[model samples]
Target: MKIDTTHLLSAIEDYIAKADEDLRDTLENEGFVAASETVRHIGEIEDALEDVLDEDALEFLERVKEAEGVDEFLSVSWPDIKNEGDLEKALYEIFRQKFDEMFRSFTFSWILAEEPEIVEDISGEAIDTITKPAEAFIKGWSGELSRIMNLNTKDSMEKMLLKAQKKSWTIDELAEAIGDSGIRNHGYRSRRVALTETLRVQSYAQQESMIQNPLAYSKRWKHIMSDNPRENHIAMDGQEVFKREMFELTGRNGETYLVLCPRDTSLPAEETVNCHCIMETVENENALGMTADEKKELREKYIAEVNEEYEAWEQKFKNDMGIEEPRDDPSVTWEIYNSYYEAYRKGEIA
Candidate 1:
């Protein structure tokens, strides 16, 4: 039976546009939570320093300047201040809770926007695709978020020491400088996370929705330029591919990548961050010249094949990354992600 997807596609487009528009507010709200934690952590660090230096910035500066290293001074005086793990833990929890909520809500809203006749029911296979990948996505992002925050802390501390040596400042002045450093910009960092991950989940949801859709046969890439547009993405506008096939994207180093959709976590941040492109699902006019029952049968068979392939890949990925299972406190690092991404580019993971 032929399926009319004109109305369904329109609804999908409208829903996506609305989601895109709301991204700014969503990011700001998440950023506010992160900002609150950042302020609290910075206050604690300042208090710890005061205890060690007796609120004498000049004395603290002179002692550190004479020490073998800033790290040595800090470590000897206030060992507990080195524990920026508190910030990492706080950020991870914020991201974990937000990601879980976004995934479920976005997926549900997308389904609800579909034409009733087109979406008879959601299947177990569809649920599996949605839930499993979302869990992995959240775990991976938590690790990534912590890594960035750790780097920020180290860099900020180094800068703080340098600034103290460069100028004659009171304790309050030094404290203010520390608060103004990059480590204290957790709210801005959270906004970046929100923008990228929101697109990630939305793209994943769109792809899975098309895969579960009996009438969806292909998808076309429609590139929407952000403030800064990627040349390759612009060149790929109107590019079409099979629903299950991957899009070939070229990196800055001229490296090639196969990604399922825009902002795919599998790709490096250079390619995925703040991407505004979209994949528009195309319905088969005649449903491939098959009845509804036949279409459903074909979809089921495809799902089984795809699931088997995916399970094997996921197992290999976990093994290669040494991730036995997802955990609340993920220790995965940026190096691990880069190594796996490199391996994937070389077709090692497949």
Candidate 2:
């Protein structure tokens, strides 16, 4: 099955652009009116946040009840479900799984709902990468809130755990500024954090969508090809790219590499924004002719050959220029490696 990287990338970009526009409108419509409100009423905002947490805990229980049969919920599951300690552990796991599904489903559904042309299967790894941070954040937030609930209240452990969200009022700001440094900092921090946490799921899904399509293409290639490519992975990008890219299986100095799928690595958010790079799986058919062990041995041999070439070139340049210092020049070596690889590909050298 051929995954259309172009369509997927465009859908993801379009979704983000639309979602961000909606979010900006929400923030502006909500935020503009609040500038004059000030911060004396921070307590009200805290109460709202608490209400979110409360609703989440209760809602989770409701979901669990709905998902599990009465026989299951009332049976062995009860022991763990009712046990405060065990329940918390179970709930976190449940939340992690639930949100992972929710974000993936929601984001994918959001696109399919609108465009309907974006039909691609997403990988578990990609789903986890995009959704895990938000899951961790929510888990931590809920756990912390549960720890602080009033024991005297009718609040259950579940309610305590889930009680959580942000912002408003003019005197709210003035009171915060006047009362305590932490108060202002706290308010600011709370709003900012709330926004971040709220946005995390969507942002991650968007970021993952930005790359998952092209990524799936590589994955599909791996799945269908009985002889998977063992050589260097190639990077392909459009006419317009941060840098229209390329890759090597082995560097001139014998440095081996594996291509990273976009958003899989820890490059900054801006780096992946609108990035059109897709990895082209390049396999050495000759490498596949050998057994697995033989393939490994050949790789080691190739590395040694490259290293020897590098050492000889460095020595030659050093002696020829009469430079006492031996410098490892990447640019010079890179050209040599490129030429060698190009020649190798053309059947001129191996």
State each model's CA lDDT, in order.
0.58, 0.36
Strongest candidate by TM-score: 1
Candidate 1 has what TM-score? 0.62
Residues 1-350, candidate 1, lDDT per residue (tens digit)?
99999999999889855754465444334321222323333333333323322322333344444555444555564344445365556556655665555565455444444422333465554533443334555566666765675556556666686566567555456556655654443444444555566566666666766766667788888787667988988887888888767778787668887777777666778887867677777888877566656765665665566566555666666687687875344554334444544555576755
- For candidate 1, which ten residues in a row score worst on lDDT? 30-39
Clashes of 2: 19
Tens digits of per-residue lDDT for model 2, 87-159? 3333334334433554565445333422223333435653333322233333443443233322212234323
| Candidate 2, superposed: residue stretches over 4 Å from native | 1-102, 113-115, 118-179, 183-185, 207-350
TM-score of each: 0.62, 0.25
